[model samples]
Each structure stands twice: as C-alpha cells, then as structure tokens.
Target chain A: MTVNAIQTRRTDPYSPPAEHLELQGDEPVAFLDWRDGRKAWAITKHADVRTMLSDVRFSSDRSYPDHPAHGGYVPGAHKGAIIAIDPPEHSAIRSRVMNEFTVKKISLMRPRIEEIVAEALDAMLDGKSEAELVKELSLPVPAMAIAELLGVPYEDHEFFEHNTAIFADSSHTDPSQRVEAIGKLRDYISKLVDARMDARGNDILSRQLDAGLDAEEAVGLGFLLLIAGHETTANMISLSIMTLLDKPDLLQQLRDDPSLIPGAVEELLRYFTIAEVGGLRLATTDLEIGGKRIHAGDAVYGLTNTANRDPEVFPDPHTIDFKRGARNHMAFGFGPHQCLGQNLARLELVVVLEQVIQRVPTLRLLDPISAIAFKEWGPNYGISELRVAW
Target chain B: MSAHIVAKRETCIGAGQCVFADPDAFDQDDDGWVVVLQADPASPDAIARAKEAVNVCPSRSISVLTRPEPGAGTGEAG
Candidate 1:
C-alpha cells in the first residue's frame, strides 16, 4: 500500500504467460490484491472490457485514486487529466487531441511516417552487422514521429523518452518518480506549444491553434498524443521482433512476401497483446460478473492480452495463425477509448514493417529469444533487448 | 431547414471526437471547447453525420435536433 513496495517489486502484477492465460479462463472478472493494499478485479473477456468501458458506473475520471495506474491510484502520487478522468471532464481533455489523432488527420502523415522509418533504419544499420532493434530503430520512430507531430524539437526525442519512461515507471515501481516524470512531460509540452504557436508551422500543434484550442488544452492534447502515440507501438516494435525471433517460420513468411506485412502485424498485435494490463477502473456501484459479486468501489482490470487469446473467442489460442481471424482481439482495446491511436500505430507498424523487410532481407536474431528481457511494469509490455543480425 | 446541433453542456467534455466526425459541421468555440452549432447544416448528408457523432461521444453530450421544413427528407435519413 505504500510507495516502498513498488520500489522493491520483483515480478509483474499478472502471472507469467501460461498461468496468466489459465487465470484469465472463463472467469469474466476476478480481483487481484493491489500492491497498495486494495482489491481490484480483472476484466478478461472482450465483451466485458467493452461493456465496462461504456458503463458510467466505472469512471474514467483521474481523481478516483481508488483504481490502480491512475496517478492517485498509486500511493504517494497525484493524478493527471483525460486517461485519469471521468465523463465530460475526461471527454474535454481527450477532445483537444482528437483532431490530431483522428484517422484522417494522422493518415495525412503517411509519407512523413515512411520517411522517418527509412531514415531511422539507415542510421541504426549504418555500419553494424548486429543491431539492437529497440534501442536503434523500434523506439525512435514513434518518439520522432510524435515529437514532429507535436512540433517539438527533434532533439527532444531523448528527453520525451526519458520523461515518458519516468511517468510509466512511476505507475509500476516508484510513485515518487511518476510525479517527476509528469512534471517534466508537462513542462516540455508547455514550452513546445509556446514555441510552435509563434512559429506556427503546418504541424499538428499549429492545426490545433488554427482550430481555436487554447494553450493548456492544446498542450494537454499534445502530452496525451505524444504518450498515447508512441508507448504501445514502441513496445510492439520490440515485442513483435522478439515474437518473430521465437518463430523463424513466420519471420521467413513475412520476408518472402512483404505485402502480407499489414495483416501479419495485426495478427502479431492480436496475438502478442503487448499491453499486459488494461486501463483500471472502479465500479461506481455493485456489479455482478461470472457468478462473482463485484461491489461498488471495487477495482477491475480489462486484461486485453488475455482476452485476445481466450480459446473460446479465438480457437487454438496458443497457436498464431496467419489465415486465422487474429483480429477482433481486444489489442487496441474496445469501446470509446479503444485506442484512439490504433490507426496511427497500425500505420507506423505497416511503414516500419515494409521498410524493415525490404531493407534487411536477411535480418535474423543476434541473440536467443529467451535472453530478451521485459519491462517490469506499465501498459506496453516489451523486451529490453532485441538484437538482429543480417 | 435549420437544425440546431446542440451539445448538452454537461455531456460535452469536448474531446473533439464529434468535430472529427464532421469537421465541416463543427468547430471549437471562444473558450477553446467544442462549439455546438444551431445553424442549418451544409446538407442533409452532413446533418445525418452529426447524428453519428452523437454515438461516438464518450459522454452522451451531443444530440442533433432536426428542424425539418415541409417535404424535407427527414423520414429517410441520409
């Protein structure tokens, strides 16, 4: 319940792969003991996650402090807006970024996205026979693209990564660091907004200005966009690479026919479900699920990865099928906040996939799949190192 | 022919999901929040879209009230 526990945490909140799947079985909802000494239920099925998302009783409002992952949800931390808020308040903050995050709006950057991936790879593979994909390529694309979209200095990529890491790490491990990250992230966006307003380049930030959004809202949206924009995709980049390494046949299949990349990526996303945990919420009132009593103020987790792999929902859950219906898995999540950045993330993956497959025809793992390390906590679950050799 | 596209101020947190749904029909107002319009929309198709925006709102904030003229195709939604 105290900040001290998270600091010395050992394993993640959820169980490991096989047991994680078993724990998620048939049970529509189950509560986990919170690190902060509270009760929180997990929403494992796709239907349940969707239903809970729209349920007014479950607040998306940030101030709750009762649910895990919300700033205050963790002991020794405060709260942020949007992702942490409920109702029109959350809606207000989300709206500020909607224009930029809109499918059409993000789609406009297709060429820019392509260019970013191409250049990032070039730099990563410059003179090395072996390269760490996540550090060199996977992370930078989203970081750069989000930074550019928000009109932040490209040089600030390292800073954005650091702050986001701090913010996310705070949620999982250290509550105090979370505050520091939030402040830094907020400050960076504020300064960037002021700078972009004066320069008013034809970027996402300037468009918000043209649309008459105020400085705070605009900056707020930028913060959300920058974070929401990259985090998952970055994890996907590393995790997907790691997943491919675990199965060489699939990697070869992708290599032979690059056109299959998009569908393959979706399957990978659906199958991987790198977002180990879903957004947390407490029931505003009593709710019954899976023959279990869920009282009001009880916490619930929408375990998207588990839901995506449920045997009933997806036949042969363990096996990854290229032709199977790998989509409809709650990877992008479900309902209202069902990943506003889905299109952008998909586009990034598509472009990244196309570029990687075409550029490195012989790309293979420099290290064994088992050796790759994963992050201890946060939404995007991924490995620490993914070394590829050509 | 003029249909007022009003947002229940309480329901609207202004995430611009509606604005993206129908950019031509909506805009942000003076307060940097969503500006719900009461004017006649650009076309019947545009008005129909204003209704879809209703569903996309995270909060039940937006409702498109149609003020139909005589013989306007209100019966057959665009």
Candidate 2:
C-alpha cells in the first residue's frame, strides 16, 4: 500500500473533496487510512473504479467489523438488506424483488408518480408564497410514493420521513438516537408485514410475502425499501432543484426544451454523485486493481464521485452539460449491485422537474446558494433545506 | 457485411441501462433479463441507438458484431 491517505469530506458543494480529485489525477489506487486506525485502498479513476466494482472479488458484506460501513452495524437487523450482503444470498434475495423495480414495472407507475408530484406541487404552491422546499415538496414526493408502493399508509409519512431522516443523515451525531429511530421504523414495518401475512395486497411487501418470504424477510425487505427508496431520491430531488435554481440559464434551457430535462437529470446525478459511500467493499481475495495488489480482507473504496468527474470519461467534467446524456456514469454505481430502485428514482426526478418547471414559472430561490445548508457529512450529498418561493 | 446487436442472457444482470439507452431496441423479461428487440439495426440512426445501449449496459451483455449476410454479399453466414 502506498502512503497516500484520503478523507471523504467535500470542500466544495458541487465537487468531490480535493483529496479525491488529487488522488484520481495522481494515483489509480492509493492507500486510504480510516481515522479508526484501519487501512484500505481507494480506487479513484473511472476505469479502475468500474474494474473493481464489477469484480465479485470485492465483497459488499458490511457485517465484518473492519468494513468501512460497519460503524453502526447490527447483525441481521435488516435480514434481507441486499446492499450489505454478498451473493448467492444477495443474488437470491435481489432476484426475488428485481421484477418489481424493472423498467416496465416502474413505467407502469409513471401516471401514479405524476399524480404524486403534481399533488406535491399543488400543496407547495397552495396559498403560499414561500416554503421550505424539502419539507413541502422534495421529501414528500418520494416518501409518499414509496409509502404507497410498500402499502404503508401515506398518512404516516411524517412519522416515516422523520425517523428516516434521522437514521439516514450521517450528520446526526447521536448514534443512540439513530438506532432508536431505525428501531421504531423496523417495528412499524414489522407490524405492517405481520398484518399482510393475514391478507395480502397489490404492493411490494405483500408480494414479497406471497413470493414465500417469511415475516422477518418480508419486514426486512420492506424496511430496506422504505429507507432506500425515499431518502436518497428525496435528497436528489432537492439537490437537483437547488442547482437548477442557482443556474438560471440551465433552468431556462430546460424550460425552452423540456426534452433536455432527462439529460440534465443525468448530468446533475453525475455531477453531484451523492452516496459517496456507495462503493465501499471488502476484498474477499487477492486482486490487482489499477496495478495495485490488494490482498484478501483488505478494505477497498471505489470513489464513484471522483470517477464520475474523470476528465477522460466526461470532458470538462466539472462543468455541468445538460446535453451530455451520459447514462454510463457511476452515479448509480456499477455492476450487479447497481441501484435497484434507479428506474423508479429516474422517473420520479423527471416527473418532479417537469411539473416544477411548468407549474411554477416564477419560482425563485429565497436565499443565495451560499446561504443554503448542505448535508455534507451524510452518506448522501444534498441540500439540508432551501428557502424558495414562486 | 452488416452490423447487428446481440445479447447474452446468461450474462445479463438486467440493470436496465440498455432499456434506458434505447427503448426501441431493448426490453426486459418478467425475470428482469435483457431481451434484444432489434438483432439488426436497419439504418444509421438505429445503429447509433444500438451502440449507445451496448455502451451503457453494465453487464456488457450486449454487443455489436459485423458479419456477412447470406444473400447480400459474396460471403457466407456463420
């Protein structure tokens, strides 16, 4: 391992941390020493990040105590949490629910998603000149969508969203509170899953139960979906809208040609590659990535944020080009572990952007970008809150 | 010779990047596996779409291969 240590903090809101960019430019793979006296390898270049993630030798199991993501790890807490497990268990579990999130299935939900977004906009703009966008629109859209998808009552969105925000936001310094929030969520989902065992519905949870998953497995899957489905997409929605508001030209471009909105969403996703921790993996075997030899049990991190900005892959990478239409970026990560809810998330983003731009033509930021608070310390990158008015 | 797209179902993880890239040329089955809708693109525009799908496919299951057509040229099909 080389003597290059790295930190995950991003100094600039729009870019990955300087340490990441420096390493990407200078080292394909470098030594990363976690603050807890643990060591790992950081793969930053686009090709190398893809090469590492695509290789199954890099395990995603987070149960290992030394795993970077194992800080607050609890064994079997979410029994079917696919992100923290390796195949064939991961493959078996993921395959069971894959069809639910397939392109066709998500497309079928488009009309419903449009309705959700429109309803959110209507509420945000109803007798209100100004509001907190995250509370009013960004959070509720995905929260309500996922709640409805999981057959959890959307009326409980405040409770669901509140606990999830506390649980998902790494900026929350209270570990005990985070655990408590998640536990409440888990119990709530457990009851939902238990009830479904008696009578099923046309939802993901009931379908999982019908597909032969036990109470615990069904509850786990539901819990994972609730957490995974909403918070990340909510963050993305807020961050994307914030960026568009900050750059009026880009906003006007999208207004002129709504066709460019999808591409703009892709570019924004790539540009703000949230989920900086998406690529943490433990090497299960000896491997060579970017010419660096990583032995078994070694921790490896694929800096997806840095990889998305690789000049070779994306010309003038820092500059957001709405016309890029590069779907090949690692914003959703790469390989079999790529985001399962991606299709649904993409559809949500497109729907929200289309409605916001069309419905609120006079929408403008109440505060400048400098005044906005960002979720810098979280597992996902996004704006904490943005004051906006139409 | 003509260029055409092919997909190996066994290798497909059904990430759906192909479907996102070119809906006209790709779709997924009930099992969430890639189903190639266009084996041979007829025009330059369609070929470009096929190439885009191939490029974005995470599993690298889709590819374009140039080969001889049985009746089109002085060459034999494989």
Candidate 3:
C-alpha cells in the first residue's frame, strides 16, 4: 500500500479536501490518516462505498483497537449502541426501535416538530434583528424534539446537549473527558429508563421498556438515539442554512417554490455530506473492492463526503443543484446500518427550512461565510455559531 | 393486470420506501427487512404502485414483474 497515494486533509471543515475529491474514481485509494496514525484504504467512489457498506464482512465494531476513528476515542463503551454493532444483534436491537422512525410514524410527529421549530423561531426572532441561528434555532429544535420523543424532560436538554457536544466533538482531544461525558449521559438516561420502567409513557424510552429490553440495553438505545437524534440533524440544519444563504439564488428559488424544499434538502445533504470521515469499518475477512484487494483486519474508511461528489455518479458533483435528483446520495450511508433516523431527520429539515425561509424573509448572515467558526474537530461538520440578521 | 414482486433481502436496509410507496404490496418483517405482501397483485393500480415502490427503494431491493398481455405474449406468462 502506498501511503503517499492519498493523504486526507480537511482544510475547510465544510468541504472535503481537494486531494480527497481528486482521488475519486473507480479505484479505492490507500491513505495514511493522521488521526489514527494508521494506513487505511479510503473508498471514495459512490458504488464502491455502497457495496462495502452492505458487505457483512466489513464490520462496524470499533472496539477493535485498530478500528479507524477520527480522534483517538473509540467509544468502545458504546458497543451496545446500534451503530457500533454488526448484524443479527444489530438487526435485533434496531428492529425494536425501527417502527418509531418509519415514514408514517415520523409523519405523525410532523405537526409537533413544526410546533417546536415555530417556538424556537419565535424565541429567536422575538425582539432582535440578529441571533446566532445555531444556538437559537438549530440546536434547540432537534434537542427538544428528541427529548420529547424519548419522554425525557425538555428542561434537562442543557445537560445532555452539553455532554453530547463533548462526546461528538473530535477536537476535544481528551479521551477521558469524552468517556466522562458519555458516562454522565448514560447515567442520566439510565435514570430515565428506570423511571419509565416504573411509570411507562408513550415516548420512545417507554416503548423500549415495553419491548422487554433490560435497563442497560434500554439505556444504550436511549443514549444512541439521544445523541444521534439531535446532533446529526442539528448539524445538518445549521450547515444547510449556511449553504442556502451562501447561494442566494437557490434561497430565492426555495422561497418561490416551497414544494421544492424536499428536493432542495436532499441536494444540500449531498452537497454537504457532513459525517466527517464517513463510516469507518474493519475488514473482517479478505475482500476486493473497486478492483483493489483489501486484507483481513484492514481499516477501510468509506469516504461518503467524497463519494457524494464522485463525478462518475453525480455530474459536476461539487456544484449544488437543487433541480438535481440526489436522493441516492450516500449522505445517510447505506446497507443494513443506513441511518435509522433518516425519515425523522428529513422531516425536521423540511419543517425547519420551510419555516425559516417563509417566516424569516430578511434573514442574512451577520458575517462572511469564511468568518463563521466551524466545528472542525467534530465527527460531524457544521458551524459552531451562525450569526444571522433579519 | 397481475404483478409478481421480489425483494433482494440482503440489500434491503429497511428504509421502508417500498412499504411507504405501496403498503398493499410490501411490508417489513420483524427484523425490518422488506416482505412482499402480494406477489401477484391483481389491480393495475397496485402494479403501478409496486413499480413506484421499486423506483423509490434506496437500496434498489424491490423488483416487480408484470404478466405479459395475453395476445402480445410469445412464450410464458408471469
């Protein structure tokens, strides 16, 4: 394997490095990732990434000391979480909670999600011409939504939000700090799980309890959902807003045709495939992908961001095209472990974007795009604070 | 019109695009994999909806085969 053949770099947190984009083609490139200080294959082509994601031989268990991870944190304690497990067990655990995320199920929550977005918008735009959209609108919307969905009291969102931020932020180099944060979040969720066991409610935690999951397992599921439910969609919202404002014509197009919101959301997801470093998998057995032979125990990073921009699948992949049909993008990953909360995320994005565009007509960035502070060290790429004026 | 439905179970990620598109023809199993509800759907609307489901499947797991028209067929039906 040639280490110099590919070197992954993120000069801009929002966009994949030019070197990564240039390596996209029918072949998988081998790269030496700085984070793990390990040599791994970077799968950049769209089809190759999809195929690898579905192949059961490629495992998602990050407990393996050699597991390819952005930061030194392996999150090994999160093994019970759906994202950290393989099939059979993964299927069993995920199936119990799958019904909650179905299109029909999430659609039922649309009115509630809209209400949350509206409330956040009202609070943000109450008496001020300018506000940090990330703090005011993006974060709280999904945070409250997930809190309500999990039957956790929304008043405690600040606790989980702060802890989740530390856990998800890649820049927080202290592994012990992340572990402590996870421990606190897990303990908090365990308490909620215990409370639900005594008095069940209609929320997701109560439902998991009904499914006969043990307290620890239930708490694991709750932790996974709580962190994933809010952090990902929140980042997507902030990034989408940033991308939308940067391109005023696209914003105007969305403003004129609200029907185009769904399509626009899909396009934005493809344009900004924010799952930093894609989904990392360990090759359990020898495999061949994109004509390149992968050895057993090799760490293969599915470069979803680059795959979304593969010229072979998407024409002029770097350019944002709202008219383009990009629903096939790997922004959500693929295969059995494809994002379980995708339907809910899509619903949240549509509602939030529609409300912001329609209600906040005068919304514009307070600073230049480059001036915005982006969370470069997070597993997900998004702005830390988006100051906007109306 | 009659339609035959098939789901490539291995590729299905349980996105529920098929069930969402045509609940009559497709449903998810306990493990959330796609399960064909009606292999030989009788209604043209059902067949059309099944095709729509096949199109929307993120994993492209669902496939529909419609019986050939009576007079236009050369060999076998279904």
Candidate 4:
C-alpha cells in the first residue's frame, strides 16, 4: 500500500481513510501513522477502537482539536454538547436529555418516520428520472424524522437540513469555512430553541427546558440530535439501495421477506459501515494500545470504517453477505459512547428500503455502476444522484 | 492484550448514564453519540462494568455480553 503525500494531503472534496490492515490471523488491526504537531494516535482495529472509545483515559474535548476527523478545524470558535467531552463533564450535560433517546421515547415517532418515508418514496416513484436520490429520498427521510422528533414543523425542514449539512460537513471544508458553518448552525439552533421555549409543548425541546439547560446548551444538544441522529441513516438509505441493486439477489431476497429488511439493514451497516472514522477522541494520558504506544494529549480517530471491514471478524472483508456470522460491526461504535440514534436510524432504513423495493420492483440503477456518485467521507457515503427505473 | 468492553450500540441513546456509571469505560462523541471503548464483554469484571453501565443508563441502551472464548479473563481484558 502506498503512503505518500497525496494520501496525507487528501483534497478530493472529502475523504475517508483508505488504509486497511492486511489480514493474517483471525484478528488483525493497525493504527494510522497520524500527522504530527498536536496529532493523536488513531486506533483502527475493531478491538482498539472499541477500547479507546470507552476508556476514560481518552477525552473528547473540542479544545484539544485532536482527532483526525476534526483534522482541519480552527480552534477557540468551537463549543458543543458533551458528545465532545468525557464525564463528570460529559455526564453533566447529557443527563439532561438522556430519556429522550430511549426506545420508548422514539417508539411514538415510528409512525411519523413511516409517514415521511412513504411521502418521499411516493414522490420519488411518481415522476422517475436520474434525480439526486440523496436530495430526494435520502435527505428528506432523516430531515423529516428529526424535524418531527424536535417538534419542528415540516415547513422548517429546509432550515434544519441546511443547518445540519453545514454543521456535519465540517470535515469537507477549510478551517475558516468550517468555523463559519458551525457558527451559522449554532445560531440557527439557538433561535429554534427560543421559539420552542416561548411556544413550549411536549416535544424534546420543551422537555429539555425542565432539565435546566439554558438557550445555548439546549440548542447545542438539540442541534446534535438533529444532525448526527439522521444524517448517517440518510446516507445508509441511499447507499444501501445502491448496494442492494448491485446485488439483485439480496434485494430480491429482502423484497420477498420484509422481516429480513431489518436484519438486512444491520448486515448492510456491518458491511458498508458508512462512517469511516469514529468521531475523534483525545488520549487523556500516555497509553499502550494494540502494541502501539499512544501519548497523552494526542488525537486519534477510532476508525470504525476500518474496524467494520476487519477480515478476522468478517470473512472476505469486502463482500456484503446477508448472513454473515459476526455481523456486529463498529458502524455504531461501542461502550458508553455508542450511537444514541442507532435504533432510529435502523428503523428508518428498514422501513424505507422495504417500501422502496415493494413500490418499485425494477429499481435498478439507470447509470452504470461506475457513474453512481459517492461522497468520499463526511459521515456520509451515498450517491449524489441515482437514476432508477421500475 | 487490549482492554475490552461490551455495548449494544443499537440499544444506546446517548443517555450518559454509562458515562457516570463507569467513567473509565464509556463516553459520548461531539453530538451526544456513544463511543464504546470495548465490546467483547468477555471478562467477569468487564462484564460487571458493562452491566453497571447498562443498568444505570436511563435509556437502557446497553447489555452485558460474556465472551465464550476459553482464554477470556477478568477486568477490562481483551
């Protein structure tokens, strides 16, 4: 494998790490040789990534600006929810909204998630073309699901989608540009939180008020949920359709047994693992992991993208199998920091894909597989455009 | 050997209960997303730690997993 300046100076819009651990034993893992000058160790193995994430020795402070995913951001302008910190600090902020992420909390919203998916799919199939599926089906499902969860009206989705795109797409732009994008999202969220407070209802925002977060923290966490909560799933919906269309057998299988869509979605998540890197974590102190020493204050990205592809855990690592034995992959991370929006994502994908196949039986890619566009990184791995014909 | 911990990411909901229950073993990322340190849940001590993290999580977005491997030992072990 080549490790040259071109790899390091990645400028293909956005890029997920392309490095892979050559599998030998039943368990093979490696660490990326990260850039120096405030750089931290990047743990890529399923084992190490899982360890580093839960290890209290690692911190998630934005002040460090350490993890590779945050590789190019400017400092001082960064402030966010506890998803960026280790507790007792992380706990102080997250405790305020813990109940909102539960199965029970989101169960009520499943009907709404279904409604949005139905609406998007109906429009998508009604007038077929080589449209950008990402903008059509992928973007809307999550945006609408999140909009409902936060009790934002469907009319407000354009604003929320814009704010989330700017916030989550930080990995793609220059440091200054990223700073501006984050500022815009924060400001937008702040206004939304205030409007909700004045018009308090039984939504998550109103509930968060009872927990004592002022306008800023409440908005920060709210913005976090809106973006991280659905963006990943949106990509999965678009990309997994591409994945299945490529494997018509799997798609047909899923079409036949709708129950399998949920498990199939899990399998797809394990196989594709859209997010290339776990969000960045800072080593709180010196540590030896996977036989490599990681010094304190260094940044590291738990490369979940790599971990999900580890051959030892997954046979023929690159293949997408519907019945793989070790299907549990790091697509959602692990430990205390595991993904909160996971079920919501899973629920959305299962329902969307199921209906997409049911509605459009001949949903084959119109363009050559090579013509399908994929975002290189940015917690999104999906086609910018997909032309489907039934 | 690397230290290990077990988590059901599908069940997790950024509750931060695991963050407080066992500060050494769990945390959230920038958007209140859970980042698991370990997921094997092999050792008894590790299993206990995971159980604590799972139990305290207000969202109950966690589960205890015990490794079937014969060599598995206790306390944050791989």
TM-score for all models, in order of appearance: 0.74, 0.92, 0.87, 0.75
Clashing pairs in 2: none
CAPRI verdict (incorrect, acceptable, medium, high) for model 1: incorrect
Cα deviation of A214 in candidate 4 (Å)?
1.1
lDDT measured at residue A98 in model 3 versus the true structure, 0 to 100 = 80
Give the CAPRI rating of model 3. acceptable
**List-wise, what DockQ does each model earn?**
0.11, 0.57, 0.33, 0.11
Q: Best TM-score goes to which candidate?
A: 2
Candidate 4 per-residue lDDT, tens place, A86-203, comes to: 6666656554566676444555677877888899888776756445576678878887787777777768777767655554444444667656866776676678788977888777
TM-score for chain B of all predictions: 0.67, 0.79, 0.84, 0.61
User: What does the i-RMS of model 2 come to?
Assistant: 1.3
Report the CAPRI category for model 2.
Answer: medium
Which wins on TM-score, candidate 2 or candidate 4? 2
Weakest 10 consecutive residues, lDDT, candidate 3 chain A? A1-10
Clashes of 2: 0
Tens digits of lDDT, candidate 2, A1-390? 333344566667888988788888888698776666778898889999888888877988888876667754332457768888887788788888888888888899999999989988888888989999987788888877888788877688779777766765555339888878878988888888878888998898888887889998887787777667777898899989988888999999999999998899899999999887889898988988888899998888898999999999999999999998788899899876889888888999999999999989988899977788888775777877889987
Regarding lDDT, does 2 or 3 come out ahead? Answer: 2
Candidate 3, A278-382: lDDT as tens digits: 468889998789878899988888888888888877898878888896566888888778888888889999999999998988899989987887766556777
Any idea what lDDT model 4 has? 0.63
Candidate 2's displacement at residue A32, Å, is 3.1
When sorted by lDDT, best at the front, the candidate numbers are: 2, 3, 1, 4
Q: lDDT of each prediction vs. the true structure?
A: 0.66, 0.83, 0.77, 0.63
Interface RMSD of each: 6.0, 1.3, 3.2, 8.4
